[model samples]
Target: MPDSHLHEPRDSTLVDLHQDLPDAARLKRLGVVIAVGAVIIAGAGIAWRSHSVGTETVTAHAAAVSDVAVVHPAPAAPTDDLVLPGQVQAWNSAAINARTNGYVRSWLADIGDHVHTGQPLAVLDAPEVDQALAQAEADYQTALANRSLAATTATRWTQLLTQDAVSKQETDEKQGDLAAKTAVANAALANVKRLRAMQGFERVLAPFDGVVTARAAQIGALVVTGNLNAQPLFTVADVHRMRIYVHVPQTYSAMLHPGIVASLDLPEYPGRTFSATLVRTAGAVDVQSGSVLVELQSDNTDRQLKPGAFTQVHFHAAGSVGTMTLPGTAILYGNDGPSIAVVGADGKVTVRLVKIIRDDGNVVRVTGALNTGDAVIDSPPDAIHNGQNVHVTQVLPAVTAAKAGARAK
Candidate 1:
């Protein structure tokens, strides 16, 4: 019933549709392939994301680590010059005080005057002492006259007793009176001698060959005898030699002994050094200061150095075998005390408590649990803690040039 061309076209269209249609078995195979591909892509994506996250975590951890510079502890020199503050004093100094009550009439010697032993420094006018001496002398003379009269009387009485004109008791009494008068005369003479001795103190004399460093007495000044609080009339000091008093630390006290020579540096005399010899020591440590007092003698024949001058004393002290040196920057002061941060082999920080024996400007001498091989952190961070991880960025020399310079100074 249809046209032949139309029927042919419809049959062709049906054939095309049948060819385009896929079988169930083929579709099943395609579905399995697609599923396998999706699983592979998802696994790859997950693995890539995990790798990126791991890389970021590693970078962040590395950034959180602290970088520090480390240094090794250096062995101290076998012998080093230990410099300490000291005071220069006179070899023989004296504070001249009055021995007798008097008024200062005149001063023969004053400050900066060189005097000889037994030389008069001042003259005291003691009217009371003079009056007393005159009285004592008059008393002595009266006693002598009494003794003479008594002797004459006793001789006459003895002669009369021989003649039997006076009784024996009367003669004995006369002899006793003569003896008593003689005793009184002796006592008066003793009093006169004591007064004369006291009068000799009117002249203030020098005790030794020295220079008058101070003069407190003035003309018309009243001086009291045996006054503990009275100012000295004069201060004399022997400057031919000087004595240096240095308070050496107890740790270095053992190095100080008699005959050891030291050098002194005074601020007044810059760039000049004076030689001194150790003469004595306190032989005991001062508990309050933890130091030992040492005496050193130096020649001042030139009289350039003065008493009571501050100086720097350089003592050649032998270092202990266990002593160690480190840069001051390595020291860490905390609430506990002075300490040092040390880096271990495992890149961990360990704080060691230390005691500072000496602190130079840039260097320090210390003793503690640290060893020569320890790696100490220089300029440690304030927040640095014990047992913390750190990255050592650099290793510094144990003794830097700056530290050496400081030690030399």
Candidate 2:
């Protein structure tokens, strides 16, 4: 009421109020737009950072798992020995039989008795031979007496013919009779000599220095003159040296030769080994066994080893020739022959063909286009193929791999 001018007009007051309301509303809308823009920008930056980190982590993991473990091929070494089965036999063997027919005589030598050449083994008493010799001697004496009488008669007949006391025809007849008697005496002497020779064979003798392995002679056993269809009186074997017969497979035939040194193992003497030498070969392949018959001579001076016994022969072959060796686990058998997995310098896998020279149950000797430094894969995964990338984990020594192969069995 005191200041009517200060109160102002109502329309002016209303206009000011409306302008203030519009300004307030515009300020609120601007604040909302700024807040929305900030939220969108923050979300975009977080999403970009997460994507980059995930991509980097994925790339690192792929690179780390790309390599495979591998091993180097073992170099071939010398001094490898091979063991094979063999049979032992006597170096020299013989069967002694009776030469003349007679009753069984007492044997001087028995089984396990050592005898020298021409030593008496047995003596046979032949009653029939004695009687035959007596008869032949008597006939020879009678023939000798007749020949003497005929000679005297022929001399008298010749003298009479000279004195003309008898005819020429009669003298000729006397001479013919004397000649016939002389021929009879010569035949009788020959028969006596033949009988004497047969009598000398009653004593059976040893043919060589050896031990008697068998004895069939007895006090009452009958002895046969001929060897046909007759059992031997004694079996002798010269065991100073033993013969080892080994039927080596054809694959190892080339390693056998005269003078090759070897060792023998016998079941009778466990842990004992005897020295031997490869003496000879059968020179031909056995069609049935597809093997070569090799003869090895071993010294048996102590007579501890016997013939027909089984033995194992050890043969030392050139390890250098057989050289490259690998674990059996690394080998693969196929129609193209044996193969192995080898890794190249480029971190890729390669399949290589190899020849197995010898198989010693656990490890095998191989010959191939691989070097000693070649990195070979051990226990390769079936999923691995040629030219596949691998990560090298460990390289094992050849000896270690060989041991592993044995354990795998």
Candidate 3:
């Protein structure tokens, strides 16, 4: 046996080394497992972060969209009555002005007095006209005397010429003098006639059978003739019938004819309607107002209706088929003219151009590519445009909106 202790130590050392080798292999496998777990956790964290960022971006975009309320267009009523404000006037009105210049001596007719045709309304004390007439008569008589003397002289001269006592030239001269005197007499007579006519105008007369509605002439008031700025002496109006002037819109101008009958409502007589007959129309639409002026006549035998009174006119206006009406606020005015914002089922906006038929402040009548069930934005934003995405906050019914518009009216 060669060194038993040394051999034992070497064998122990070898066994220990073998056991450590297995431990080292286990440790290496453990490190590999740890590294794989770390890589998987990092990947999960990064994916979760990216998903959270995407969700935030989507929420921000949704919050930025505009919200709006929508309403549906309502069907226009058929056979709708058109009511408009009208003015009441007299059938025949005249402003009685003085024909000649004079002082008003006396007034025979006062305001509210009914006078007949050619009735004297006032008498004027025109001293100047009287003096002129007297002078004209005196001049006319002087001219007549001169004409008589010239005629006698001419007859005497003709006799002398026949006997050769005077030359033919003398006889011709006498005849020419007579002719000149006759012309002067005729001129004076014409002047006298003119002055007499002026004298006849001393009494202001009524032009027709009517009631005196105004009296501007007072006793001793001096009147002037041919003056445009002068006020009339009296205002006479025929009250047997009344005239009503109504401005019918161009849309309803076709329905207004001469034989059409309408009703009038006066605030003075509540609940009472006066029957009126359409007498005439302007025949053309007024450019400024886009309406036709119509004249209607109403019998005022009882004299209940007065001139210059405000009244309401009502007509049975014919309605057009397939007409649509919407709230006036829904109309959008842009460079392309009038349009409306329509929302589709996908919440996308499609701006459709429209033609405005009428606007009654609360409601508007239009014709365009629109339906009864299509949603229209009410009071759309100015920036709202075509292809815009909008979130609808409320949807109003067509009937309810119509009733509301009617109430607003």
Candidate 4:
């Protein structure tokens, strides 16, 4: 009955309102759920990205660096060598001192005077020594006379005792006296010789063929002998050969021996270099300086080398084989470890750990899984990473001596 009465309702109203009611209500609920779910999902995504390690992150600036050329290690064959900071010195420096105390009567030579081995340098008025020698000689003469007399007397007494003219006891006494006189004579003669020998000490003679570098003695001056603490009156150095002393680093002490070849340079002569051979060394390193002292000698018959001049030395080490050298910039030293960034055949970057042997300012010597022909990145920036695709460009600038000097500075 109600359905029949619905005929009274408008047919257009029933059709329109009923058809849209169910769909409109369902669509409203669905929109609200979708909005809430979208916001929750977005918050979770932000949290996840923040804690993950593989996510994008930014870093600060890294240390600035330079690149160096790589070369091979030194071979084990003998090669020319050198050292730094050497000194030019005399082969033999002799300080002539007064052997006896006396007044200087006259000086025969002064500084810079060329002298022979036995050339007289100075003269002393040692009359006291001469007088002592004379007195000793007189005493020795008297002793000899007495000894001769005693010998004759002893011989006469022995003959008299054999003939029973003198008593045995008396002959024994004479024999003893003779022997005593002979001993006294011999001692007196020895004293005379010693005093005579000292007479020549008044004259100072050159110890060897050299130059007189000093003159402290003057006429009428009193000098003392064996005063080691005082300065010498004359200094003589052998000019034929020169000694170059250098303080080698202690780390290289073990590598040096008595005989080794090296090159030497003097500051006075910038372009001239002389051949120097290692003569001797301290054989041990100093605890304080971490260095060893080495002595070298060079032939200077032409008088080319001079003493008291500063010089440089270059030492050749034995068994030095070279290695493939690269610029120091290629080595990336960090708290993590020592590593290098290498480019693969596929144009990709692969960082590897390596061992560095030596670092010469311009080049860093290293050994690893690198080949000689491999392309290395010079002066790489810190932004590079492992497994990165990179384009390599070989950049080499013509370096001058001035530029090298700046880098060294």
Candidate 5:
């Protein structure tokens, strides 16, 4: 029975070995398992790749829609005015000084005193001039007496010659002596006249109708005649009108004429504008300043405007070129000179070349191949290029181009 059992186990082990060995079904099953695993891995890889590609596409789309600020160019006027610095001055000013040596006796006028032409401003006590006048008078009288005696002697000599009481030579000598005495008398008379004229200067008089802007005259102040080193007695200014001197740039020189209208603005009188007429201009340009000196006159009958005041002169100029103004931030300075970033209606960025006319800190005046309807990018990015897509984050309010032009006027 034990032998029978061993034989049966052996037979079973053989059957099991055959089953575990490579069989068609088993090999087919193993191949099927490997094929299923490869299919599943390929499907997973395809899914992961699709997901990564989708994420990348979304990220790229997000980057393409960049937010940018956009603004519309301000409407520009056909004509723009120019404002320039000017110097205000008196129409006519003079420094009054002593014409003759004297001491200040009394001043009839002080600073801020308005007087007429030939009006006495001060009285000067000129002792030397008085003495000289007196001496000149005495000399003139003596010369007159001598001239009279010479005339009488000359007449008598001629009469004597006719009577043959004296020689012709002696008569001629007497006539010559009389001529010499007459010339001396004439010189003395001239000296007397000169002294008298100089004495008249002792009364300091106004040269014209004007106001005394300054006075240095004091009681008993000694003044030398024609002394350039001496301080002036008074400063007389014709305040009936005021003169403004402006150095206009050569670019605008052609627009200026003798009658061009200009307005004056002063710091002292804010909001009060004075109308001015162009009086004259230095036709030639100054090499040093590269500008023309223009003179303008304004009526100051009320004496409101004063001399030597800082002023702003506004010149109305007509613009012939199509110019536009934009905010300063819209301008972009690049290697290709000044340029601006413009946005197309389709939201494409396009850089344009521009010519700048003026810069007023926050505003810029530009002229180029641009239209009023074009949108300009404010504070453009450094890497911005032409034909780049942009997404406008905000549309700034329309800036008034007329304000800058108005200020020019």
Candidate 6:
């Protein structure tokens, strides 16, 4: 221990002597340099420690943060309406036609002309019918003259028979002649009446009260009987009311019943609707389309609704009692099937499957394992998964022109 202490002192002594004389001035300058060097070393260590602490703080802050879309929960009870589109048509329609074979001498009506029942629609020039009538009339006249002469001769013969001037056979012959003449006269009268009735076919009359919607024949044009090469001279439609026919998908066929209330809409009158009533069904389903034909009736007393105009029909079905409606914009279309994200209480995202009953244009009615006030991501996420950990913030309402606004308020 003493030797160790002596070695330490000898080093001190050499240092003290070196610091004392001749080199004292040099020692003073050296002392100042050594103090300054110590100061620079201490400052460097302090600065390095401060810089390290700052770097650690910045890293911790970055790790705690993330950029994500946020959303809020909705109520469990949902009540949304479902809407669908449809078209309109006429209730009663018929193609007015010519019943007799003749030429159209004059058209008394045109398109949009409203006519009453039995109104003369057109005049037909039946030259052949006229000639036939003339022949029949001349034959009737000759028959009448012959019948008159036979009756006078039979009267004279009967008087002679009463005086026993003629035999029984002769008398019988005279009586037969009178009877034959009377039958001929009666036949002539029948013939004349039949000919007159046939001539009446030259006039075209409206079967019912309606507007003429089509005109195919002009004056001097040949019109044929039956549905042959000759088309109908005109098409008449009763525009006082209209019918809307729709082919509803077979899935909804069961829900439909006759006499159900419905509505009609025209694109020309956006956002407006006309009430209608379900009259009947086509009774059979279409094989190719898998749809059922539904007929609805509408009143058009003002004549505002025209036949052949395309219009939409809204079938007011009996909505589910406790159903909920969701904005379609919030529903996400995905590859594995449709799904929506729900942020759990633990800040983790969980996806859920939904059953869609009907898909209209804007809103949808759905049934799923979700409730009101449950924050669900409006749109499906990209590369996002079910049961994933997440940090959620309130996001803007989907498809709305708004910044982040609290929906709870």
TM-score of each: 0.66, 0.63, 0.72, 0.66, 0.65, 0.55
lDDT of 4 at 281: 84
For candidate 2, write residues 1-409 as lDDT tens digits: 5888657766533334234467778788678989999999999999999999999999986774455556566766665566789988898999888767898778899999999999999888888888999999999999999999999999999999999999999999889999999999999999999888778778888989999999988987888666688778999999999999999887677666788889988888999899998989998899999999999888899998897899889987666463677776677776778788888878778888898776665677788888788887877765556787777878876753347446777
- The all-Cα superposition gives candidate 5 an RMSD in Å to the true structure of 9.8
Off by over 4 Å in 6: 1-87, 145-194, 320-409
Among all windows of 10 consecutive residues in model 2, the one with the lowest summed lDDT is 11-20
Residue 148 CA displacement from its true place in model 3, Å: 4.3
- Candidate 4 residues 147-246, lDDT tens each? 9999999999999988999999999999999999999999999999898778888889999998777788878877877776777878888888888888
Model 1 agreement with the true structure over 1-409: per-residue lDDT tens digits: 8778655545433334334456886677668989999999999999999999999999988976789999898877777787899999998999999888999999999899999999999999999989999999999999999999999999999999999999999999999999999999999999999988889999999999999999998999999988888999999999999999999888677667888778999998899999998899999999999999999999998998899999999987666677788888999898998999999999989988998766665788888998888999999998888888899989998874346776777
lDDT of 3 by residue, 1-409 (tens): 6877655645433334234467778688678989999999999999999999999999988976679999898877765566789999988899988878899999999999999999999998888989999999999999999999999999999999889999999999999999999999999999999989888899989988889999998999999899999999999999899999999988667656897778899988999999988899999989999999999999999998888899999876555566688888899999999899999999899999987766666677777899898999999987888888899999976643347557976
Where does model 3 exceed 4 Å of error?
1-67, 80-84, 103-105, 148-176, 216-231, 246-261, 277-295, 391-393, 399-406
Q: Sorted on TM-score, highest at the top, how do the candidates line up?
A: 3, 4, 1, 5, 2, 6
Output the TM-score of candidate 6: 0.55
Clash pairs, model 5 backbone: none
Clashing pairs in 3: none
- Which candidate ranks first by lDDT, i.e. highest? 1
Model 5 misplacement above 4 A = 1-76, 251-255, 321-409
Which candidate ranks first by TM-score, i.e. highest? 3
What's the CA RMSD for each of the models? Answer: 9.7, 13.9, 8.0, 7.9, 9.8, 15.5
Of candidate 4, the 10-residue stretch with the lowest lDDT total is 59-68
